[model samples]
Target: MPSSINPGATLVLTGVTHILVGLTHPRLGPPLLSMVRSGLFDSITGISLDPTSSGAPQYDRMAAWWFELAGAAMILLGISIRENINVAGYVPRGVAWGTLGVGVIGALVQPLSGCWTLIAQGIWMVGWFGKTKME
Candidate 1:
Protein backbone atom coordinates (compact mmCIF):
# COMPACT_ATOMS: atom_id res chain seq x y z
CA MET A 1 0.00 0.00 0.00
CA PRO A 2 1.08 3.58 -0.67
CA SER A 3 1.99 5.89 2.22
CA SER A 4 1.95 9.70 2.60
CA ILE A 5 -1.71 9.86 1.68
CA ASN A 6 -3.99 12.01 3.77
CA PRO A 7 -7.70 12.31 4.26
CA GLY A 8 -7.55 15.92 3.16
CA ALA A 9 -6.33 14.90 -0.29
CA THR A 10 -8.99 12.26 -0.59
CA LEU A 11 -11.66 14.68 0.46
CA VAL A 12 -10.46 17.31 -1.95
CA LEU A 13 -10.40 14.82 -4.79
CA THR A 14 -13.85 13.55 -3.96
CA GLY A 15 -15.15 17.08 -3.65
CA VAL A 16 -13.75 18.09 -6.98
CA THR A 17 -15.13 15.01 -8.62
CA HIS A 18 -18.54 15.68 -7.13
CA ILE A 19 -18.39 19.22 -8.39
CA LEU A 20 -17.64 18.02 -11.90
CA VAL A 21 -20.41 15.44 -11.77
CA GLY A 22 -22.83 18.01 -10.46
CA LEU A 23 -21.88 20.47 -13.13
CA THR A 24 -22.31 17.87 -15.80
CA HIS A 25 -25.30 16.08 -14.39
CA PRO A 26 -27.73 18.02 -12.25
CA ARG A 27 -30.87 16.41 -10.93
CA LEU A 28 -33.22 18.60 -12.95
CA GLY A 29 -31.33 19.51 -16.10
CA PRO A 30 -27.89 20.08 -17.46
CA PRO A 31 -26.92 23.56 -16.36
CA LEU A 32 -24.14 23.50 -18.88
CA LEU A 33 -26.70 23.26 -21.68
CA SER A 34 -28.81 26.04 -20.26
CA MET A 35 -25.78 28.19 -19.75
CA VAL A 36 -24.71 27.46 -23.29
CA ARG A 37 -28.09 28.50 -24.65
CA SER A 38 -28.52 31.87 -22.98
CA GLY A 39 -26.59 34.32 -25.10
CA LEU A 40 -26.63 37.03 -22.50
CA PHE A 41 -25.57 34.63 -19.76
CA ASP A 42 -22.89 33.03 -21.89
CA SER A 43 -21.42 36.36 -22.91
CA ILE A 44 -21.64 37.75 -19.41
CA THR A 45 -20.20 34.54 -18.07
CA GLY A 46 -17.54 34.64 -20.80
CA ILE A 47 -18.83 31.41 -22.33
CA SER A 48 -20.50 32.61 -25.50
CA LEU A 49 -22.04 29.88 -27.67
CA ASP A 50 -25.21 28.94 -29.52
CA PRO A 51 -27.85 26.54 -28.36
CA THR A 52 -27.93 22.96 -29.51
CA SER A 53 -30.00 22.49 -32.64
CA SER A 54 -29.70 18.75 -32.73
CA GLY A 55 -32.89 16.85 -32.06
CA ALA A 56 -31.13 14.64 -29.56
CA PRO A 57 -31.22 16.20 -26.16
CA GLN A 58 -31.69 12.76 -24.67
CA TYR A 59 -28.50 11.59 -26.31
CA ASP A 60 -26.69 14.53 -24.83
CA ARG A 61 -28.18 13.84 -21.44
CA MET A 62 -27.09 10.23 -21.58
CA ALA A 63 -23.62 11.29 -22.61
CA ALA A 64 -23.42 13.64 -19.67
CA TRP A 65 -24.50 10.83 -17.35
CA TRP A 66 -21.71 8.63 -18.65
CA PHE A 67 -19.24 11.43 -18.18
CA GLU A 68 -20.41 11.81 -14.62
CA LEU A 69 -19.82 8.11 -14.11
CA ALA A 70 -16.32 8.54 -15.41
CA GLY A 71 -15.80 11.41 -13.00
CA ALA A 72 -17.00 9.21 -10.17
CA ALA A 73 -14.56 6.52 -11.21
CA MET A 74 -11.75 9.03 -11.12
CA ILE A 75 -12.75 10.08 -7.65
CA LEU A 76 -12.68 6.47 -6.45
CA LEU A 77 -9.35 5.91 -8.08
CA GLY A 78 -7.91 8.99 -6.45
CA ILE A 79 -9.11 7.88 -3.08
CA SER A 80 -7.89 4.33 -3.54
CA ILE A 81 -4.46 5.25 -4.86
CA ARG A 82 -3.93 8.50 -3.11
CA GLU A 83 -0.28 7.80 -2.42
CA ASN A 84 0.73 6.11 -5.65
CA ILE A 85 3.20 8.61 -7.00
CA ASN A 86 0.72 11.35 -7.58
CA VAL A 87 -1.70 9.14 -9.48
CA ALA A 88 -4.41 10.85 -7.54
CA GLY A 89 -3.44 14.12 -9.16
CA TYR A 90 -4.50 12.70 -12.51
CA VAL A 91 -8.12 12.42 -11.46
CA PRO A 92 -8.66 16.14 -11.96
CA ARG A 93 -6.13 16.18 -14.69
CA GLY A 94 -8.10 13.49 -16.48
CA VAL A 95 -11.30 15.43 -15.92
CA ALA A 96 -9.76 18.53 -17.41
CA TRP A 97 -8.24 16.65 -20.26
CA GLY A 98 -11.47 14.81 -20.93
CA THR A 99 -13.45 18.02 -20.82
CA LEU A 100 -11.02 19.73 -23.12
CA GLY A 101 -11.13 16.80 -25.47
CA VAL A 102 -14.90 16.79 -25.60
CA GLY A 103 -14.95 20.54 -26.06
CA VAL A 104 -12.55 20.31 -28.95
CA ILE A 105 -14.58 17.60 -30.58
CA GLY A 106 -17.77 19.52 -30.00
CA ALA A 107 -16.21 22.61 -31.50
CA LEU A 108 -15.19 20.73 -34.58
CA VAL A 109 -18.67 19.35 -35.11
CA GLN A 110 -20.71 22.16 -33.57
CA PRO A 111 -18.83 25.36 -33.10
CA LEU A 112 -21.12 27.27 -30.78
CA SER A 113 -22.08 24.42 -28.50
CA GLY A 114 -18.56 23.05 -28.55
CA CYS A 115 -16.98 26.37 -27.69
CA TRP A 116 -19.41 26.95 -24.87
CA THR A 117 -18.71 23.60 -23.25
CA LEU A 118 -15.01 24.14 -23.87
CA ILE A 119 -15.12 27.41 -21.97
CA ALA A 120 -16.82 25.80 -19.03
CA GLN A 121 -14.40 22.90 -19.03
CA GLY A 122 -11.46 25.24 -19.43
CA ILE A 123 -12.51 27.19 -16.39
CA TRP A 124 -12.91 24.01 -14.37
CA MET A 125 -9.55 22.68 -15.50
CA VAL A 126 -7.89 25.93 -14.50
CA GLY A 127 -9.41 25.67 -11.07
CA TRP A 128 -8.42 22.03 -10.77
CA PHE A 129 -4.81 22.83 -11.59
CA GLY A 130 -4.65 25.74 -9.20
CA LYS A 131 -6.22 23.94 -6.26
CA THR A 132 -4.48 20.58 -6.32
CA LYS A 133 -0.94 19.57 -5.46
CA MET A 134 0.98 16.48 -6.52
CA GLU A 135 2.21 14.02 -3.96
Candidate 2:
Protein backbone atom coordinates (compact mmCIF):
# COMPACT_ATOMS: atom_id res chain seq x y z
CA MET A 1 0.00 0.00 0.00
CA PRO A 2 2.82 2.40 -0.76
CA SER A 3 1.84 4.47 -3.73
CA SER A 4 1.68 4.85 -7.51
CA ILE A 5 0.99 1.85 -9.72
CA ASN A 6 -0.04 1.43 -13.34
CA PRO A 7 0.31 -2.31 -13.79
CA GLY A 8 -2.11 -2.47 -16.67
CA ALA A 9 -0.06 -0.35 -19.00
CA THR A 10 3.14 -2.16 -18.09
CA LEU A 11 1.66 -5.57 -18.73
CA VAL A 12 0.10 -4.47 -21.99
CA LEU A 13 3.30 -2.96 -23.26
CA THR A 14 5.32 -6.02 -22.32
CA GLY A 15 2.78 -8.24 -24.04
CA VAL A 16 2.87 -6.15 -27.19
CA THR A 17 6.63 -6.34 -27.23
CA HIS A 18 6.57 -10.12 -26.91
CA ILE A 19 3.99 -10.43 -29.68
CA LEU A 20 6.16 -8.28 -31.91
CA VAL A 21 9.15 -10.43 -31.16
CA GLY A 22 7.25 -13.53 -32.17
CA LEU A 23 5.91 -11.92 -35.34
CA THR A 24 9.35 -10.80 -36.39
CA HIS A 25 11.10 -14.06 -35.58
CA PRO A 26 12.93 -15.15 -38.73
CA ARG A 27 12.02 -18.81 -38.63
CA LEU A 28 8.42 -18.49 -37.52
CA GLY A 29 7.31 -15.29 -39.21
CA PRO A 30 6.84 -16.75 -42.68
CA PRO A 31 4.72 -19.65 -41.52
CA LEU A 32 2.74 -17.39 -39.27
CA LEU A 33 1.99 -15.09 -42.17
CA SER A 34 1.01 -18.04 -44.29
CA MET A 35 -1.38 -19.25 -41.63
CA VAL A 36 -2.87 -15.80 -41.33
CA ARG A 37 -3.29 -15.56 -45.07
CA SER A 38 -5.13 -18.83 -45.01
CA GLY A 39 -7.41 -17.33 -42.37
CA LEU A 40 -6.69 -20.45 -40.30
CA PHE A 41 -9.60 -21.80 -42.29
CA ASP A 42 -8.00 -25.21 -42.49
CA SER A 43 -8.39 -27.56 -39.60
CA ILE A 44 -5.48 -27.47 -37.20
CA THR A 45 -6.69 -30.37 -35.12
CA GLY A 46 -4.51 -33.21 -33.83
CA ILE A 47 -1.29 -31.36 -34.50
CA SER A 48 1.20 -32.36 -31.86
CA LEU A 49 4.69 -30.99 -31.61
CA ASP A 50 7.21 -33.38 -30.17
CA PRO A 51 9.16 -31.61 -27.52
CA THR A 52 11.82 -34.30 -27.76
CA SER A 53 12.48 -33.46 -31.37
CA SER A 54 15.99 -32.05 -31.69
CA GLY A 55 15.78 -30.74 -35.21
CA ALA A 56 16.42 -27.01 -35.53
CA PRO A 57 13.18 -26.44 -37.44
CA GLN A 58 11.08 -28.29 -34.87
CA TYR A 59 12.68 -26.38 -32.01
CA ASP A 60 12.14 -23.08 -33.78
CA ARG A 61 8.46 -23.79 -34.25
CA MET A 62 8.12 -24.76 -30.64
CA ALA A 63 9.83 -21.63 -29.45
CA ALA A 64 7.76 -19.44 -31.71
CA TRP A 65 4.50 -21.09 -30.66
CA TRP A 66 5.26 -20.74 -26.99
CA PHE A 67 6.34 -17.15 -27.41
CA GLU A 68 3.18 -16.12 -29.22
CA LEU A 69 0.98 -17.99 -26.77
CA ALA A 70 2.64 -16.40 -23.77
CA GLY A 71 2.28 -12.96 -25.33
CA ALA A 72 -1.41 -13.51 -25.91
CA ALA A 73 -1.80 -14.64 -22.34
CA MET A 74 -0.07 -11.53 -21.09
CA ILE A 75 -2.41 -9.33 -23.09
CA LEU A 76 -5.39 -11.16 -21.68
CA LEU A 77 -4.04 -10.88 -18.17
CA GLY A 78 -3.38 -7.17 -18.55
CA ILE A 79 -6.85 -6.44 -19.89
CA SER A 80 -8.42 -8.44 -17.09
CA ILE A 81 -6.35 -6.72 -14.43
CA ARG A 82 -7.12 -3.32 -15.88
CA GLU A 83 -10.82 -4.06 -15.82
CA ASN A 84 -10.61 -5.32 -12.27
CA ILE A 85 -8.75 -2.25 -11.11
CA ASN A 86 -11.30 -0.04 -12.80
CA VAL A 87 -14.04 -1.76 -10.83
CA ALA A 88 -12.27 -2.24 -7.51
CA GLY A 89 -9.98 0.78 -7.35
CA TYR A 90 -7.08 -1.42 -6.32
CA VAL A 91 -5.27 -4.56 -7.36
CA PRO A 92 -5.37 -7.36 -4.85
CA ARG A 93 -2.22 -7.69 -2.77
CA GLY A 94 -1.97 -11.37 -3.59
CA VAL A 95 -1.74 -10.58 -7.28
CA ALA A 96 0.98 -8.05 -6.67
CA TRP A 97 2.99 -10.34 -4.46
CA GLY A 98 2.54 -13.24 -6.80
CA THR A 99 3.84 -11.21 -9.69
CA LEU A 100 6.79 -10.10 -7.64
CA GLY A 101 7.69 -13.64 -6.72
CA VAL A 102 7.37 -14.74 -10.30
CA GLY A 103 9.54 -11.88 -11.46
CA VAL A 104 12.19 -12.64 -8.96
CA ILE A 105 12.34 -16.31 -9.80
CA GLY A 106 12.24 -15.73 -13.53
CA ALA A 107 14.86 -13.02 -13.38
CA LEU A 108 17.08 -15.29 -11.34
CA VAL A 109 16.92 -17.88 -14.09
CA GLN A 110 17.06 -15.44 -17.03
CA PRO A 111 18.44 -12.09 -16.08
CA LEU A 112 18.13 -10.73 -19.62
CA SER A 113 14.44 -11.44 -20.02
CA GLY A 114 11.25 -9.43 -19.54
CA CYS A 115 10.93 -10.61 -15.96
CA TRP A 116 12.29 -7.20 -15.04
CA THR A 117 9.09 -5.61 -16.22
CA LEU A 118 7.10 -7.94 -14.02
CA ILE A 119 9.38 -7.00 -11.16
CA ALA A 120 8.72 -3.32 -11.75
CA GLN A 121 5.00 -3.88 -12.01
CA GLY A 122 5.02 -5.82 -8.77
CA ILE A 123 7.02 -3.15 -7.02
CA TRP A 124 4.71 -0.46 -8.27
CA MET A 125 1.67 -2.43 -7.26
CA VAL A 126 2.92 -3.03 -3.75
CA GLY A 127 4.44 0.38 -3.10
CA TRP A 128 6.68 2.61 -5.10
CA PHE A 129 5.58 6.18 -5.60
CA GLY A 130 1.96 7.35 -5.29
CA LYS A 131 -1.33 5.74 -5.96
CA THR A 132 -2.94 7.16 -9.11
CA LYS A 133 -6.50 6.78 -10.23
CA MET A 134 -7.09 4.62 -13.25
CA GLU A 135 -7.98 6.56 -16.37
- Give the number of colliding residue pairs in candidate 1: 0
Model 2 Cα lDDT, one tens digit per residue, 7-58: 7657877899989988997876766676666575641333448666443444
- The TM-score values for the models, in the order shown, are 0.30, 0.69
Determine which window of 10 residues in candidate 1 has minimal summed lDDT: 39-48
Against the reference, the lDDT scores of all candidates come to 0.48, 0.70
Give candidate 2's error at residue 37 in angstroms: 8.0
lDDT of 2: 0.70
Maximum-TM-score candidate: 2
**Residue pairs whose backbone atoms clash in candidate 1:** none
